[model samples]
Target: MTSFTRPFILAAALATLPLTALADPSVAPAKDSLEIDEPGGVPAGYVLKWSDEFDKPGLPDPKLWAYDTKANKHGWANEERQYYSLARRENSRVEDGQLIIEARKEDLKNKPDWGGQHYTSARLLSKNSYQYGYIEVRAQLPCGLGVWPAIWQLPTTDHMMWPDDGEIDIMEYVGWDQDTIYHTVHTGLYNHVKHTQKGVLKHMPAVCGQWHTYSLTWTPDEIREGIDGRDYFRFVNEHTGKGAWPFDRPNHLILNLAVGGTFGGKTGVDDSTMPWQFRIDYVRVYQKPE
Candidate 1:
């Protein structure tokens, strides 16, 4: 249900922070030096592969990112109400060294693909794809009911339908469930509709009010998801068949902030919470040297 169908497909520094630090939403957190394997805490053998520090203040680097608005005319998956805008600075921008993906309560009535939606947002896809690596993102989440923020990955092959090529949810946080964070993996044999998706929910009381690191260390044998250097979820290749593990193919990254969907708006959207934001400090990927 969290699928970004027709999608293309498509950091982090602080190992941990004190509980007191999580209370302030305005106080910025320390920036990670991202030296060597410190970004995702991968093994020393891994080398820096790619990264976007969001240093330039404007749209995301065109060389490394592209927009995904293929399903804007129609509604997005999970019954999301937001229209993913294309190259719109109002929805996606870089400022003060961070990538800000904002979900605003506005209607793009003039756009050809408007579709009568009241909210506009952005969904960014990585221009490059990878088979295996340690990927990391440090971000601060937005709040208020109806906000659904995510950092995930999907296969690059347009031929492979979802749940067949595999999906890796590095992090998912719905504003309605403001205190918990989810990490999951889906495949033909294990998905949400079937009530068999493999996932883990962790209590992150200040997730929406402070900065946190979310990451995926993907290898040939398994995929591990972690936060602030602590692993919480992992999926090991069962070697049974593609139904259970279809992750060998190249996959790209996705970063989006959806609104009023089945998961985020199940309880109903809070209009007062308009203009929610998902702030990304940095994104880094690392892989072993060839």
Candidate 2:
């Protein structure tokens, strides 16, 4: 989940917010922006703050989602071969009550933004940001070599600068390593580059063919990662300094299916799996009342 490159540009509107406003994750959005529907099964003490069921049949709701194509032209941080398309339905679309992020074997040399990549896929960022909250996503993974799917969060700041700003990888999976999943946290003092990241690995045999819920519960005290309501990993706040604990500030969500990256392509891509679909059922975030 630690991209070798710096974070890409987020929404222009988010970048213009005052630092004070951006720093406070407790600052609520307009009440009307809270929910599309009152989601059920929420924990007793937490209230549903935001959600996207992907019930609408079309591109993801623009108000709730934005594309990440800034790194495509120069290739992605991990030498990913996919050219993440911008607002292209072929790469990302909603249908049959699911968000389908498809990775296809193709070239977009004709497009002005095409980055000379052999594959095309999608990377989406949540328009909203959160501080301490419980975030969950239900989805079925795509299988076969070279497929890299991830659900993660990054600092929501225009000045975001890699590990220093911190990253929370709620879930990450590579095709070659079927049924295995990873949950990791990166900060200035701990990261993969330094071989000191806080991470967990789990094996779930039904990971690719079944729908599973991956989640992150974050608080001022610690961050926990879980699958199907069962917690398997936890990173506690040491209260040492920002270098070790930067989760106090707001971070936005990210959903992407990358193909042929430094990690995903360790065994090379399988062309037969030309069009692989990464299906997402829903994304919901909840926060305890202050």
Candidate 3:
């Protein structure tokens, strides 16, 4: 199913000596240094409210995140290939001051809830939800055909189905389209299944191999998305009712790396790219001071 219909949500190579070695470190430029001090630093007028630096190693902090393990049984709403593992370090973990969500090709057939899938990954949802704020994530994306990584949000209220409640795709990248990044917003009145969603595609050639910030500046009036602090996508409150403007309600964050699905599977997967990693340096949310 297309992301638009799913209720559940959830690479520029380095220049190198040889074609295959383009992404190899030996010939590529030095690794992009982490600007931890102020990576996507707090916006000018907003004050930091919460953040996860992944300073402590092991699984993500339980106080800030929860796993969406239920989707493993039926393959989520998109027919994704990987099982969303819970509390499994191999799927999601923190190391060297960063959070890593790794997708691996493995046979989980022996496990009852495996769903006969050959891959395993993780989907993390923030425990705290907010109505509006400046949200930012600094990370390096994964590349290879069939990989789908996303940083997005969904309404926090239960029983609030998609579209009707709203979905915000702060950042989405398909491995097949290595040079572009997508930002989209979905609502009952505007969604992809209907080919009416409000979205934008930005050419970011270095996105997959370097560290960059993906952010959203949301308010009662509008929602703005950006890369590296530069706003590139915006959706204003149409004042047409909840169908078009659900930003007034609180929403929780989600970070996940999915395998071949409707969009990600368009060109088919390269099993050779069996292992991929989505590294997140940090995530911070800021809001106007009360």
The candidate maximizing lDDT is: 2
TM-score of each: 0.86, 0.86, 0.85
All models: lDDT? 0.76, 0.77, 0.74
Off by over 4 Å in 2: 1-43
Candidate closer to the true structure by lDDT (higher is better), 2 or 3: 2
Span of 10 residues, lowest total lDDT, candidate 1: 12-21
Candidate 1: global Cα-lDDT?
0.76
- Per-residue lDDT of candidate 1, residues 1-290 (tens digit): 01112334321011111111111111121222111222336767987788899999999999889887767776666677989899899999999999999999999999998878999999888887877888999999998998888898877764546666677888888777789887777778776555566767777876796999899988878888888887776677889999989988777888999887667776889989778889999999888887
Which sections of candidate 3 miss by over 4 Å?
1-42
How many residue pairs clash (N, CA or C atoms closer than 3 angstroms) in each of the candidate models, in the order given?
Answer: 2, 0, 1
Candidate 1 wrong stretches, greater than 4 Å: 1-40
True-vs-predicted CA distance for residue 180, candidate 3, Å: 0.6
Candidate scoring better on lDDT of 1 and 2: 2
TM-score for candidate 1: 0.86
